[model samples]
Target chain A: MGKNLREPLLKLLIEQKEGYISGEEISQRLICSRTAIWKHINELRSEGYQIEAKPKAGYRLVYRPDRVAPEELIPHLSTTSIGRAVRYQRSVPSTQSLAHEWAKEGAQEGSLYLTEEQTAGRGRMGRIWHSPTHSGIWMSLILRPPIPLNQSPQLTLLTSVAITRALRKQTNLPIQIKWPNDLLIHGKKVCGILTELRGEQDQVHYVVQGIGINVNATESVWPEELRPIATSLAIEGGRTFSRPELIGAICGELETLYDGYLSYGFTPIRILWEEYAGMLGQEVTARTGQGSVKGIAKGLAETGALLLETHTGVQTIFSSDIEW
Target chain B: MGKNLREPLLKLLIEQKEGYISGEEISQRLICSRTAIWKHINELRSEGYQIEAKPKAGYRLVYRPDRVAPEELIPHLSTTSIGRAVRYQRSVPSTQSLAHEWAKEGAQEGSLYLTEEQTAGRGRMGRIWHSPTHSGIWMSLILRPPIPLNQSPQLTLLTSVAITRALRKQTNLPIQIKWPNDLLIHGKKVCGILTELRGEQDQVHYVVQGIGINVNATESVWPEELRPIATSLAIEGGRTFSRPELIGAICGELETLYDGYLSYGFTPIRILWEEYAGMLGQEVTARTGQGSVKGIAKGLAETGALLLETHTGVQTIFSSDIEW
Candidate 1:
């Protein structure tokens, strides 16, 4: 069977979602042999699409696997730019590394690299990001923004706003953004954003934003050590959400926010970011390499640096681990 | 006969610089046959080293090629860190590209990628850097600085100071730094520096400083359009200089300046840069993408941006071409 027949067959199945269509009907619609139809059905099954083949009834898509496959996500994606050219992988070491490689080879501005499982997922400061299989969003987005190198930190904050807004639309639970790039819900981290940039002094060549979200993972999926600090959407809401729909929402939100950022500047995004930032006006401690800084988390600077008011003065924290 | 024999024979020739060493004597000293010694001499000649051979008089070293080979440059290098591991290439697309690749693969700090000729050399703001064969220093140095992303432009200014000081020590010609990263002699461009960096918001992964100096090119060596604006050391000084020694001096000066910048801060380097800057206090027009700003070139900011005092106000130019 030709590879081109799979999409047409998928379209036929989706169009006839009411009931199963006969093999003769499918063959007539797709202009292929019954044997070829069966081959494509097996291929779709191997790709984690559950198809029930009865004796009288021909075939029906019984269940769609919880994967961010291009076939599953592309149809639901509403963004015109982001996630348009998706590089879907079943398993990889890190989507950020792959995205960096592709960006070096001149990947498009809005190209996305997504994976089902990350063998060596990484977070900020060389920490391990626990990316379990088929239960979260493990993706990296490549953006070529014509901004100064100093303004790159603001992208992380802007991405935090986008992710938080996307999640807020999907669930009834409250979403709050931690200082730099962590998305928390109910006082536990549910998402992490790591933004890496490569460029010269004045201009940015490309920025890779790697985001890992715990969407559908249950309480039991997290390791013992991480259970106290981490929680997923399923654990908080007691339901498994559609990973494709969630990914689509995130991409659309990010694209809209990113475009606004580039057009009107960081002022709009900064305002939105502060609304979701739960740390502002609260007392917190930032653990830096030098020492610990205890202060009132005043707000974010226009450049997206954390402005903390301590006893000494106002300190601008570029990077640090936060503790309330 | 073998690649190993070339180095031993070259070592013998250097050791016996004042006199010719016979093939039989070289074979006895290095445990190789006379025919093998002759073959290695032919290989050395193919590599652009001029060797004179007379019947029964054996071979003598006549001239060393103006190539930035590891063997030629490493012995003269005095730096403890910079240019420690030199990856010499006869020809490459661009040393910056190669250095970026090596840095991505975890190349050590201070590793250098040097090329004799670049097929696609790059300048600032997508300009074409004319790199001819064996007439300039076309190299990139990798640095891993632990600083904020905003402080990276200071490195470019620091590197400009290093190159100016290095050239000033080697020659009596007056060397002047033009605002950001151009080194000029007699009001014409003699060298250019391009600094590229990769990092996150707070920590830098690596920085590739690509420096190209027009060292030994004659007036005719430059392209017709570039002859008026571009000049080389050989053209200005009326003599060819030793490229290896100049490269060694630049590397040593850069390593010293970089170490000082890391330990103390950008203050020392900024002071040195001001001393070498000739554009300060002069009226110039900065041709930026937005528009042109005509003002007196005041000085550099602590962050290394060019400060211009126009009629309206003081403007900081992040990137632009200067015209006086």
Candidate 2:
């Protein structure tokens, strides 16, 4: 009734910290009857919310399922624009495609599309991105920056820096950003960012930044081939983290950095990115479509290209797969 | 019958040169009954195809409607990849959006979308492109080129060169390319090209090139504001031209130029573009988002950017509206 009053009911239950919220108290807070409150509580219980209900003690939330439901995440998300307008789906092929369609249909600049799992998710150059159900944070954010076409790569770099800072602040694991779009924990990748641009010849219409993080996933989430190089926060930190909380923290950090990027230019983001970068001065090979370039990693160019000190000279890589 | 035999039926009628094909003979050629052939002829007559039937004689094709139907264009088109797979709409808002959606849905690399008219067509920088009904060529072509992101502007320049060459060869009027996106007939804009790129950070997935040419539109087709600036081939050349023929010529030229661009690079197309450029040595002011740059219009950069010789120095303009 009334479009399922479970979200507000769940919000009220989460707000009550110390004790139980009586059925009558919930009815008064939500402006509903006692029978309606009882029904909602039963539905929540069926959905894996361990709510204890007693005759005198009323109702209390004991535990919540490990799900990134909007009802659970909305209460924790604190942002002015980044996560304010969100489209959450239970499962999808890829949030990137959905975000692109929505962006073309006039989705707001900071709209976010969150999915519990991606069946046919993609990485850079059409690589397969493993996104199992209810195990990680798989989402795409739509950004409409009034910048030139050549500078769009900076948005991807800015996003990596934001996510790396968010993960660094949330967990004790040492998160390092491998140029240009990976987050590693002790040399194993914990997250990846793929930023796609749709625009005219010289101006960007919108950008879809797809960020996938193995937050609460364990080692079992990775396939056999990826076991040696893939990792998650739970595997590295030896403890599970809240997916909703991590999503909120990432949205917050991204909003701050994105605002700074728009106002003061990319200098601030570039500096933070250099600090988070872990492969500077290391011998590496960048495999591109043309060939391979082996060199010592120097830094990032002004336009966010990877700068390499090759034997010939300082080379700038626009697209490549890094191997150390 | 059999999905409207008008296309093949029209082809049969056109192949017979100076005389009429007997009704009995037509039925044998098309493997249809004589009554079915008569009914199809009536249907074609109702759709503005003038067929004369004489006593003891057969039907003779007298006149054809001035519509760019696929049935009318397919036989004349001679391209290997371009215009091979086409989607035609009677009316649509914009072919650009439709081509973009189709491209995302795995439409082939050389897919072309054509519309009889665009109710809400768009030009560069989100400007309005007036596309009246059945009077111009409004189409979009999808191309998946394996080129880097910075080189995308060359596609737009290459398209301009192709369209200018086609127009010059078809009509004897002096057709010129106004830098970046517009085609001019004696200094009045006649055609416009808007090339939109959709891709990841460093590589291109596909490019949708929207081309709109005012082929047979009369002077009254333009609004009062655009009357002084806009011109059509019919207005400039003092006679109407076939829209389908122009569309076929454009696709043929574009396919040849695009193939050369992929194999031999942008030098050939750039040379042709410079020859058709009307404002090369003229004094012009480029109004950008930041400010205006007044200079002598020198030429194009290797990357297809407009080069301007200002009093300060040579400035390369990526996006701007030009004023003389």
Candidate 3:
């Protein structure tokens, strides 16, 4: 019922090696009823983890499913509370939409959002993001930074740094971050991040970073035609990688980078992002609202905008869809 | 219903001389129905207008409402399309809240919002705005401009220009716009504006302009002490003005200025706003989140930020609550 209940239960279940635990021990330590423990277990099942239980043997979490659940994920996270609060929804129209609303209604800082499905998910071009129920990780991170609105593009680099570092740390599959907001595997799309901001004149209240990664989704789960162009971690890894582990690692990485940026500016994250951005120094094209322009990518400016050295001059692209 | 529906109805109803007409006439000419006519009529009544009816005499408009409504107010409104789309709620918690939700739902450009009451109104200094039910114009404008995020503060100046023009044109009561976001009546406060932006990295998605004006509210409406610092349009004019008329006029003015900004930019509105800002040359004390400072108001910068010539230098305040 409370956001705290699931967290302690998750830590308890993880520590018990056989995944078998007596309900009595959990009740004595956490000071909750066996019924409360069962309820959270049921909630965890609803969020897609598998548990085997017997009346006499108590409950046994036999399968820690690769799914997004705060309780199962947060305990393993090595974070300084950048994403200390995890809000998970069974299904939402858009993670960014719900995150934006929650941020306005006074959601806490570093609130990490996870949704099993996004019915009306959004992409960069105001297009519908296809989030076929529980097939991928669809979530948004809400960050309230003490920074100017113009400096917000720096957050894109910061998030790329966090996500790229997280993927590198948790998975063996090679993931490359393209300029702006793309993640690719073997040059096929694997993930995308869209950062939206709300502010007072020039002060940014919060940035809702929506990241959708194709995880265990196979070709069958994807739309028929998209199978050729899109991929998931399962396809790339030849096995289903753990979603909770990936999410936990991402939250920790994000927290570390966000804290660093707030304290010391974007220098730390910017350096890391440059390493992961494979499109730097390559022939690139950007599709702005005006029109598409081709240029040699000259890396990013200190402000985090993409520096596209064009035929005329170097243009700082504050926003665009990148192709390299 | 679309906001433009009322403008033609206002003209047609006025031509009938008598304020009363049969529901059949409205339905027949407008190709609507008796039910729709009655529904909109009921809506106009909630906005504080009085109507009378008899079987043979049909319906008679006993008195024009003082509050803002689409029908009576939109007729006199002059603009291409700003006030053309109007939505009104009698007792919403806040107009800004309504506008924000609507914006996400793909509400159109130049949408005009008005509310009779705000259960939780807000002021610049995180203070509660005294908005008695049916006592003030608690409204917000939702705009989706083509400009980048940095150019958004000009919207505040554009909004001030529209509001000041509407107040001057309607009341002859003469009001001045204080730097940042307050509208002054003689010496006391009459209106306030809160501008919030939603952007994509560096591109602005939408801007919600929240405006609260004390129209028909009396001194008694204020908690005993606030009477000295706050005054209403009704008190200043010595007569209750129709809020619907004023609302329509302001929407019209806003549309004009908004169009002016899109076509010609904020230079015109900036010049116009400077004339009404009386503290431009005066020594004033400002309390910001950083601290308090005594400075002379040099003028407004090109981007609509107030240029405060402090002891250190001319600081451009992009976001702050100013009290003079």
Candidate 4:
């Protein structure tokens, strides 16, 4: 049933690569298929894929959806995954939630979870993130680093550097990583990271790094409130870029940073981070649970802690909400 | 069946608290269950409850197993749980392993796990712990702390103070909290802590604290190889201590320490830890995955990261296998 219905449609498209195949030819090739091919083609078009099919000419591949495709991406994909194994969804509540479930089900290292939009996406401090359907890159990567639980915080800092590097290296647009996990393009946020982990008492079992990047999105696609603070590559560069290429670049950068952090502490990554980090050695305020501490950011500590020189002495901030 | 089994057993041992009860009286009080009473008594004896069945005097309750009972241990339990709810097993491969499964099954915060003998108990650095059946407190506490994933290492250091305080207050035996999470009595290992967390992205869903304390083990029971390095409470105090009491005390202390960390930051617990920690201010060397660092153990920073004064400068030690 599956092979016969699509074989004629495939052959017609292959023969007439210039344009669409007539419904009569499609019907004659399979002998029981013109309507079947039309139905299946409609389904494909609904997935943001621009399939131009006319009454006489047949079908034309006008636009391919700018999403991650395994066949097209895997060859150029570097870093042995961190995304090689993938589960893709057109829509989901959040990539982070599904990644945790997969990790619990014994999903191995290098598992990647991708979704078109997050219905209940959240940023650090429980803030809601504006994730519109098919306008952003929403994905989570699962990794089992051979490190203790105490050192997991460094992973988040390291991930931020990787995202910053990828956005810069893969595209001509300038990017800067804000303190914690915000990715900024020319002083406006372009992406954010949320790192999660699961483990057994002091030993880290796995980590899920969720990244959401605003790409190919119009300024109007964001809420009336977010336009001032957020921008997509399409908005900044006047053209939309391929999401799969961006994903490939980020995952490759992340795996490289992970190797550096694992083998040789955070020294090398810190140097790379210092180059792309915003607000370093600048006066900023961090609102932790207790209250707020306004101080000069003194760069990162050796063990990957954010050091802030506060009025009450050099108060080394380990974990908190950073406000510039 | 359950009622008949419990009532007769309770009635037979009501007045005969201090000494043994005769087997015949046990059979008689059980009424339609003379043979049934004998079978139940055998079951009770196997649970490490001391039942002396003297000649014609009947079965007496000489001793009860010194471990937390889900019934008796529930009410006096304090703290927002973190282990207020209880689940126990007589023998299990590992409490941490079982707890991970429970967490997957949506185990609530304060849900606890305990086992009498851990056939495959584990410690930090992937080492095996000597968990001789009913001779120590082998338990795991489930905590759902709402902190960022990276901030979890502080919870490990915070759990150490709780264990140390509970050991001192309940057992009246002084114990030193080793850096990160190890309990030492008279400079010999007696207890260890392993903290695990579950989360996705920025928010931490849960943190499970697994603690093992050697309460009633004798020096002879200690392996000849480990005798020089490890000592149990019985060996240190020259007497057998109650396991249930120690477990209850630890739970109570954990709740308090957790409260302080969540509300007031790690400062309160870090200050208290400074008082009980044996590693602080001492010249020591620690082996982390990255490399070894030798330095004077300063106090913990605000984020629970260990501050070590090495030859170069004050270095923050996150996770390490101590070589003191």
Task: Give me the candidate number with maximum DockQ.
Answer: 2
Please provide, for model 2 over B1-324, each residue's C-alpha lDDT reduced to its tens digit, 9 standing for 90 to 100: 664677788998888766888988888878888888888889777545689998778989997768877888888799988988999987799999999989988989778999888999999878899998777899999999998787788999999998988888899779998888999987899999999989986589999999999987877778999999999999999998998898888989999999999899989988889899999998999998779999999998987899999999999898888988
What's the lDDT for candidate 1?
Answer: 0.87
The lDDT values for all models are 0.87, 0.88, 0.78, 0.77
lDDT of 1 by residue, A83-150 (tens): 99889888899999999999989999899999988989998866899898787899999999997776
lDDT of 4 at B3: 40
* Model 1: fnat (fraction of native contacts): 0.63
Candidate 4 per-residue lDDT, tens place, A185-204, comes to 87898998887777743468
- lDDT per residue (tens digit) for residues A196-254 in model 3: 98877646778888999888777886677788888988888888877778888888788
Which pairs, if any, clash in model 1?
Answer: none
- Model 1 vs truth, CA RMSD: 7.9
Q: How would you encode candidate 3's per-residue C-alpha lDDT over B1-324 as one tens digit per residue?
A: 445556555555557676568777766788886676667667655655565656755666665545465665677677666666788866777777788888888888877787777888876534688778778888888889987666777887888778888988899988988877888888788998888878786467988888888988878778988988898888999988777777778877787777778888778888898888878888877766567777888888876878899889987776666666
If scored against the real structure, what TM-score would every candidate get? 0.80, 0.79, 0.68, 0.78
Rank order by DockQ, top first? Answer: 2, 1, 4, 3
RMSD of each: 7.9, 8.7, 11.3, 5.9
Best by lDDT: 2
* Candidate 1 lDDT over residue span B1-324, tens digit each: 477787778888988876888888988888988788878888677555789997898889998777789998987899888999889888899999999989888888889999888989998866899887788899999999887677788988988999899898997779999977799998999999998988887677789999999998777766799989999988888898888999999989999999998889999998898889888899999987568999999888877899999999999887788988
Which CAPRI quality tier does the interface of model 2 achieve? acceptable
